[model samples]
Target: MTNITKENFDKAKNFYNFDTLYAPVLPGLKATVMKHQDAITDAFYKELANDEIAAKIVAGRVDQLKATHKVWMEELFNGEYGEAYFNRRYKIGETHVKAKIAPYFVEVITSSLRRSFAQILVAEGAVAVQAALAILDLDAMIIIGAYHEDRMHRMSDVTGMNLNLLETLMSFG
Candidate 1:
């Protein structure tokens, strides 16, 4: 997995326009998201439960998953997208890998999260929606990226090959 160094985190902040764009709207967005976070968490997990395999994957951990997801949901709006935040998001990816979740599930979860939050966020108006989305985008991107990186690293470790060679092999028909 990629290290969540300050430089990496700052680059993410810059790419997402965290200071100029996201920060201004985050306070209100945070308030709104916090107000509705329970609904968001419930909807997200409920969506997860609708899928047979996913439901099995989460079978015995719904409560724990809901609690962790609630924190992640609220944290997105908290306006503190720093190194610690990046590390936390990266850890989310690690957890997914450890759980043997397919990378495609990240996309599904992100979609579910968007569904759960979009209408309420839209009510906050365009700027707020955009800002909130920046955070969500960062969260999903980090999780997905970390998931792939860690998987690649694990493969490399097992095969005693460098990442570039592994990448080439993976790309083969």
Candidate 2:
């Protein structure tokens, strides 16, 4: 029940160097993403559509998902890494779980995004590469972190095991 706490958010921020001087590059990131959004998303959705399960999951929601994806990408470069931001990102993870989004699809989409951003940045004169990647990593960390914690909680409940015990068992070879 406590997976998405402020403490965890802070820890994730620290892990990702969220307070970097490189943050000034956020505007460049924002500009590049906004400018190239259509192409970026076209490629992203193309990759998603290549996967049968992901395509089916998003069968009737391509436009809706595209809109949400743009919003998510915009928020990535907003340079407002606060607890509320963490809450929003974590809520996304929770939503993915509820939508039955597999971790493979999560990885696929994130990889697609990273590659798209990186390529666009390189093409657009490579602004704030470190800062851009750092923020992206932070966003991914929060989302995946919440997704994992939520999955853990559900598993713990179904198996009647404490989270610690479930985690211990998961660590076994």
Candidate 3:
């Protein structure tokens, strides 16, 4: 698990232009996000239920999923995009990879979330399409960063093992 230090968080925030692009609309978007949480969560799970692989991963865990997802949504809109936020998001990515859930399924879930929020925002006439996209893009970046970080860690482990094996073989020679 990446420690999500302040340095890396700042790097990611800067790389994503989160402060300029996302910070401005975050305040206005919070209420809108909260208002549509249930619909978004339900739709996410509904899609998961339909997918055989995802359904198996979530089987017998519906309530837990809902509760945790709700909390995650709340944190997302809480306007505190700091170390804790990135930490939790990174951990979610690590959890998905460790559980062996396919990355495509995670993409599906994020797409569902983006679609749900876009519909709500557009319907209420509260946010412009461009701002909505920035928000969704920020969300996607964080999620994708988590996945990439986890994969890098796994790759590091494998590389370490391969190097150790090469060293052992050299010793035998």
Candidate 4:
């Protein structure tokens, strides 16, 4: 047990080693997604298109929106989670807002992402993929949190309205 714990810890630590230690481990994340992007996308689109709420929201925007979504998915597997990547993410969020997509779609996207990750993890292997996904999930959560916070703050400033009031109304959520 001690040895197993140590091994997992060591493996987790390599994610931030700033070396190639975690690079090869990422092939599973990329390879599986690359091989099954179509299936994943199909599943995603099916969910979105069939969704009574989101379908009405995403309608008419699907054709143009797919290209942006495709790039975002590819960028994730490409390990390009840099500053520009973050900017693009926020931009897409804003685009969704402009397109009248409900905030609920964010939850849907998160759920879909989790399912896709699980499929990739199982297809690749459990042990290594689990460790790598741990790091990836943590890092992604941190970055996404920061990005969303900044985006909301910016929106608050631009609209000159307090979003906190709206948030308070949705506190039950």
What TM-score would each prediction reach against the true structure? 0.84, 0.84, 0.76, 0.61
- Report the Cα lDDT for candidate 3: 0.70
Tens digits of per-residue lDDT for model 2, 19-129: 665455686568867898888877888888898888898898999999998898788788787767878988887788788887677776777777777777775555466
The lDDT leader among the candidates is 1
lDDT of each: 0.78, 0.76, 0.70, 0.57
Better candidate by lDDT, 1 or 4:
1
Q: Can you write out model 4's per-residue Cα lDDT over 5-100, one digit (the tens) per residue?
A: 233334545555622544446544766666767776767777888879877876787777676656666766555444454456545555555665
lDDT of 1 by residue, 26-142 (tens): 877777788888888888888889999889999999999999888787777776776678788888877888898888888987876766566888876788777776777777788
lDDT for each residue of candidate 3 in 1-173, tens digit (9 for 90 to 100): 44333345677678868777766766677787788788888988999999898899999999999999999877766667776776677677667778888778777677777777777778646444445555555555666666665665566687764533543454596
True lDDT of residue 78, candidate 2: 81
Q: Which ranges in model 2 have alpha carbons more than 4 Å from their true place?
A: 4-9, 123-127, 164-173
- RMSD for each model, in Å, please? 3.1, 2.6, 6.3, 9.4
Error (Å) of candidate 4 at residue 101 is 2.5
Give candidate 1 misplaced runs (Cα > 4 Å): 3-12, 164-173
lDDT of 3 at 120: 76
Better of 3 and 4 by lDDT: 3
- Collision pairs in model 2: none
Lowest summed lDDT window (length 10), candidate 1: 1-10
State which candidate, 2 or 3, has the greater TM-score.
2
Q: What is the lDDT of residue 66 in candidate 1?
A: 91
